[model samples]
Target: MPDIISIGEILIDFVSMESGVTLAQSPGFLKAAGGAPANVAVAVSKLGVKSGFIGTAGNDPFGRFLKDTLNSYGVDTCHMDLTDEARTTLAFVSLTADGDRDFVFYRHPGADMMLRKEKISEDYIKSAHIFHFGSISLIDEPARTATLYAIDIAKKHGLIISYDPNLRLNLWPDEETARKTILSTLNLPDILKVSEVELEFLTGIRDIDSGLKALKDKTSASLILVTRGIEGVDYVYRGERGHVETFKDVKAIDATGAGDAFVAGVLYGIHERINEFKDGHMTSKALQDILRIANACGTITVTKKGAIPALPTIDEVKRFLSERLER
Candidate 1:
């Protein structure tokens, strides 16, 4: 049994080797295991915490590789399914001059869509203290229903729910539908991580404070984090708010999965102080420390290429913080 369980998409990422190019301009790519929730799973596991992944991967070469990759990171995949219903999903990523990412997905009917509600085990979900997910799987069927059902189970079992909309506008049929669909379920998670832009899109407010206030009114989330890339994270926890700055001056080559790495850091921090979070007594100072590590995770990730491979281990994160302290 794992302390954390993350459920959703598991796929391959084809990252363009060259920076400062669009997908059409990039000449080549590097195949790597990715998918937001899966990245969180591996990132937490790398921190030496027990985490499990539950989702569907195709019974193909890419899918098999993803399964092996999760295992290599010591992530539990007991409830993971390998299905023949659809081929694995693939996303081609190209980078801008500033290491920002642009994505083009190749999933007519991705194997991740094969995530079956009936196959999800209630006991497995209950075994964990936290359940993490993203909205990508919410874009379609089977997975949508399955995600809802799992959320229901996690809530019933009193697991701390975590959501990072991980919104990819291109994946949706239209912006309005994406907004409406995601908005309808805001009241679900205990923890919510959204980028500053995501909060703006969801709340229709450019002002970060007003947007966070709007989101807080809608959800039961005790903690809401707004990531601003290298600018760092702005957060509100149970009515107390603050900002945490990221590591300064680190060269970035690829920004893929940095958000996921940050998500894992936050979750692992809560996982460490499960009782305090569950009891609604987690202080802003404690959370500040947590976000600092999360920011470190994000910074360390951008300095490398690919998603999973870039995620730092707990020791790696500790070393990073130690070095920063010694500076």
Candidate 2:
């Protein structure tokens, strides 16, 4: 049985090395595996965890490549679906000279959004220790309902629920609907991960503390993790709260999947019973360990250039930890 089950979109990201000066401007593109949930699965697997991806993809070349990539990373794809209605979702990312990115989607209701309620098998969700999801699948029909249904089942089975609002403004019809729906589901998660910008947008509060308070008051999630680029991660647990600084000084090439890596690190540490020092209580020591490991993972991710491909192996993470410890 898989220890982690991630349910949501699985697609291809075609990132541009150059910026678009105009609508007709074309830049050199690099194809890579992407999708928030898929990245989580790869991250978990690379960290020596038993992880699985449950979603749909097109019956096309890109879809096959996605499937093959997941298997190569040691993620179980037994619950993956191949659909004929739509092609795989493609995201065209354009990066500026400052390393900022803007995205243009090529989604016309792709296969990932076509995941059906019927395709969600009960056995799959019940077997996992944690169930993870994001908001992209909540933007569309069949998939929207399907994702919610699976969450319900996972909750019923008493699994730890993790959510990431991983917001994409281009995918949603309107900001209001996205804000309402994403905020509404916050209460259902045991752990929540959101970027600083996401916290602001979701709560309509510019201050991190105010936004975090609003989220906690609404969701009552046991743990709330807020990620800040370069600065590192800020976490709020039931009994502990603080910021964990970056593990090392490393030049970041692409930060596409750094948050996902942090999530994977948190889950990995928790699953290995590394938090036992806290004895089920959110003690300061436990929080420190979690933060340190998570920072190391995130730092490793940024050193590489892609999402899934950037996930570090166990040895790599250990080396990072050792290097940091020696400093």
Candidate 2's TM-score reads: 0.94
Per-residue lDDT for 176-232 in model 2, tens only? 999998988987888889999998898889887777887778785788889888777
* Residue 119 lDDT in candidate 1: 86
Query: Model 1, which residues run further than 4 Å from truth?
Result: none
Give residue 230's lDDT in candidate 2 (0 to 100). Answer: 78
lDDT of 1 by residue, 95-159 (tens): 88778999999987999988989988999999899999999889898999999999999999999
Looking at model 1, residue 49 earns an lDDT score of: 92
* lDDT agreement of model 1 with the native: 0.93
TM-score of each: 0.99, 0.94
Poorly placed runs, candidate 2 (over 4 Å): 18-26, 274-279
Best by lDDT: 1
Q: Output the number of the TM-score-best candidate.
A: 1
